[model samples]
Target: MHWLVLIISGVFEAVWATALGKSEGFSRLGPSIIFAVTVIISMGGLAFAMRELPTGTAYAVWVGIGASGAVAYSMMTGAEAASIAKIVCIIAIVAGVVGLKLAS
Candidate 1:
């Protein structure tokens, strides 16, 4: 179940990152609160997962998920421009995340 926790943590990482972007330099109250809360939870979950998962593996997966998810979310929400190159980069991040997990 460690891997499950790690995945959940990664999801939370995505959430917090998106929230941070919406927070608008922390001027927006609601998103700011959400950003803070999710950041804490995401890190907490990562700490728990690290008890079993290797540090390199867990950190790479966490960062990869956050990066890819943020870009995808931005694209879907029309918050950022989308392009073939962006999509390819997202895929590459996914592959790297998978490769790290598999290597561990």
Candidate 2:
């Protein structure tokens, strides 16, 4: 159950990160609200999951999931370039996150 929550929080991390970019430094209201709300929710979920998981494992997994997911979304939307190197790194991030999960 805690793992599930952690994963979901990781997804929210991507959401808040993407929204933060879209927020344009808070000049945009909609995405700014999204960023604010999701930031709280994501952090809250992370805090909750931390109660049941190791600090290092939980933090690393959270960051990995968020970073890779946001980068993938940008690549897919053409907001960021989709180069071979970038793809490889994204895969690496995902692999690391999964490895952490499995190790846990």
Candidate 3:
């Protein structure tokens, strides 16, 4: 359950990141609100998961998920240009996340 919450929180991290970019320094009402809410959820989940998980491992996994997810979302939406290198990097991040999970 903690792992599940952590993963969900990581996804929310990506959502909040994207919303933050769209928020334009909080000038946009909708995206700003989305960012605000999602960030809190993400942080709360992270804090909760930290109770049972190693801090380093949890943080790395969370960041790995968020970074890869944000980039993938951007690429899929055509907000960011896609390249073989980018795809490979995302794959690597995923692999690392999986590796961390396995190690744990």
lDDT tens digits, residue span 14-58, model 2: 999999999999999999999999999899999999999999999
Q: If the candidates were sorted by their lDDT against the true structure, best first, what order would they fall in?
A: 3, 2, 1
State the C-alpha lDDT per candidate: 0.91, 0.94, 0.97
Candidate 1: residue 23 Cα off by (Å):
1.1
Candidate 2 Cα errors over 4 Å, as ranges: none
Give per-residue CA lDDT, model 3, range 1-104, as digits (tens).
88999999999999999999999999999999999999999999999999999999999999999999999999999999999999999999999999999999
Question: Lowest-scoring 10 consecutive residues by lDDT in candidate 2?
Answer: 1-10
Judging by lDDT, tell me the better candidate of 1 and 3: 3
Q: For model 1, what is the error of residue 53's alpha carbon versus the real structure, in angstroms, after optimal superposition?
A: 1.1
How does residue 101 of candidate 3 score in lDDT?
Answer: 91
| Candidate number of the best lDDT | 3
Q: Which of 1 and 3 is ahead in TM-score? A: 3
* TM-score quality measure for candidate 3: 0.99
TM-score of every model versus the real structure = 0.94, 0.96, 0.99
Flag the better candidate by TM-score, 1 or 2: 2
Error of 2 at 15 (Å): 0.8
